[model samples]
Target: MPLYLTALATLLLTALSLGPSFAHVLEAPPRLIVWSPELWREATVFNGQFELFARIGGPLDVAAMLAAALLTYLLAGERPAVWFALAGTCLLVLGLGAWFTLVAPVNAVLDSWTPGPIPSDFASIRLQWETGHMVVAAAKFLAFASIGIAVLGPRLP
Candidate 1:
């Protein structure tokens, strides 16, 4: 069981970390540049990379959720194990929910954006989009960290 938990935790951690890692590389640097519709549109183009990452990472969430469920079932009657499983499951839910509600809408708009003149409302929309991504990244990082702690916390001492 410990080995199984360790393996699952590693996979979940790696999967969750990808969001922030990619965001840092792809999204963070642009904030340092002058904000413009053209700039924003260019940034939108780069977001396609993130979309690709999401397509791959999205399925891992389901695997993590199932791991939690299986852990709960296997460790039935063990309070800590059950709680950890619940925490892992809840964190996944929160992270994915934020992604869909906060990030996906922005992604849709970005996908349609062209390279020409920027839209008048681009700044406001970009702010929302960037802010939404930051929020989702934080949620995912927390979820990953929580799962790690839950799985490995006891063994530490």
Candidate 2:
């Protein structure tokens, strides 16, 4: 029962954490190609909305990582389930690593911007940010799939 609960929690948290990354990926096509001024305006406006996501998402991401780790442990001796859980946990960690290394630095720059002239390097920064999210989304999607397989795969007893 505890194993089942942990598996469910891992799946739910990982699925939820994918939301913001997926949102960024969906918006990247249009956002990436827009004029600097337009992108600046959109970025500033969109940045405000992310406060809510940050508050909710930060803990959720951490929770998902922990849950994946826990699920991996709980599934020990369960053959392919344990292997899949381990893969899912590693993918989640990889996603978080990409977020910190790729996304957070650009976020710091974006957060520091004012209403004045957009940075000359805004395009590069935008590219970094968007690409980071796409990478994160891919990692997270794979993590979710791996975790799901762990939970649903045949048990070895």
Candidate 3:
């Protein structure tokens, strides 16, 4: 019961945290791929959008998963539940580590990237980093969503 409550709390928070990013994204001006300046701005916006899954909100997802796995462990007396918790913990730790080592520094760069008269080299790097950010964001979202469904889907009754 405690685990279920904990998972729900985390899910609610995740939903809350992601809401504004989605809102900003939807309201953003349309862009053309050929326009480098516009692309730069779009890149910046996309980078900001990536924040939800790569930051602490992501850890919340893992924590929720761990809580659910532990709940299963406690209730069912099953080895799978224990395994799931351990797996989820490891995933979260790795995700956190990757965020610190790779993504966070790039995020700082993205934050500081002013939106005027970008150099070709700067644009290239920005695009590359932006692509990487998207990849990580997708992975994190998938992890969170899968864990959520795995834990909560069955309990939806």
Candidate 4:
């Protein structure tokens, strides 16, 4: 049961983290830029709307994941068992932390980059930021999938 709960947590978080894949991005010829400026605006607005939803409900989801970790500890065994549960929890935590710390802010900067920008370097920086966000997002997906698979496959002990 604990393992299932852990898997559920990972599954939910993964879906949340990666579920917005098509919101603001699309495939262009060679550069991965917004295919539709209108779509970019629409997607950003939609994201803002869902963010209100997250504000109302996101913490509860996080709390559930934390609770699942403790439940695994209590329902399972001692050190080694707890360790696996902890790792599963940590993968989500670490991935989210990476998203907020390392990726999302750069995304914000890129989104705010202007036509009358400071320098050509700003565009280059925006490109780098976009690339980094994609990499970090992919890493988040990997972490999420790993957690989900681990939880599905075995108990902590």
Worst 10 residues of 4 by lDDT: 21-30
- How does model 1 fare in lDDT? 0.63
My TM-score estimates for the predictions, one after another, are 0.74, 0.93, 0.53, 0.54
Query: Model 3 compared with the native: what TM-score?
Result: 0.53
lDDT (10s digit) by residue, model 1, range 1-157? 6748644754464466445535643655466356555655765565464565666677766666666556556545655655665676676677678778977787778777776677777766777777766766666566666656656656321
- Model 4: residue 138 alpha-carbon error in angstroms: 3.1
Ranking by TM-score: 2, 1, 4, 3
* Number of the top TM-score candidate: 2
What range of 10 consecutive residues in model 1 has the weakest lDDT sum? 148-157
Write model 4 residue lDDT over 9-73, tens digit each, in one string: 55675556554422212332233453344343344333464474347334643654565455456
Cα lDDT of model 3 by residue, 1-157, tens digit: 7766755654454444344334433433332244466565665555565565446566565555455455445535434443443454344445445556655676666566665666455655555454444444444444455445545444322
Task: For residues 1-157, write the lDDT of model 2, one tens digit per residue.
Answer: 9998999999999999999889988887877666466665565445576787689888989999999999999999899999999999999999999999999999888877777676788778878888999999999999999999999989887
Local distance difference test values of all predictions, in order: 0.63, 0.88, 0.50, 0.51
Clashes of each: 0, 0, 0, 0
After superposition of all CA atoms, the RMSD between model 2 and the true structure is 1.7
**Model 1: runs farther than 4 Å from truth?**
1-26, 32-36, 155-157
- Runs in model 4 deviating more than 4 A are 1-6, 21-84, 107-119, 155-157
Candidate 1, residue 50: lDDT: 55
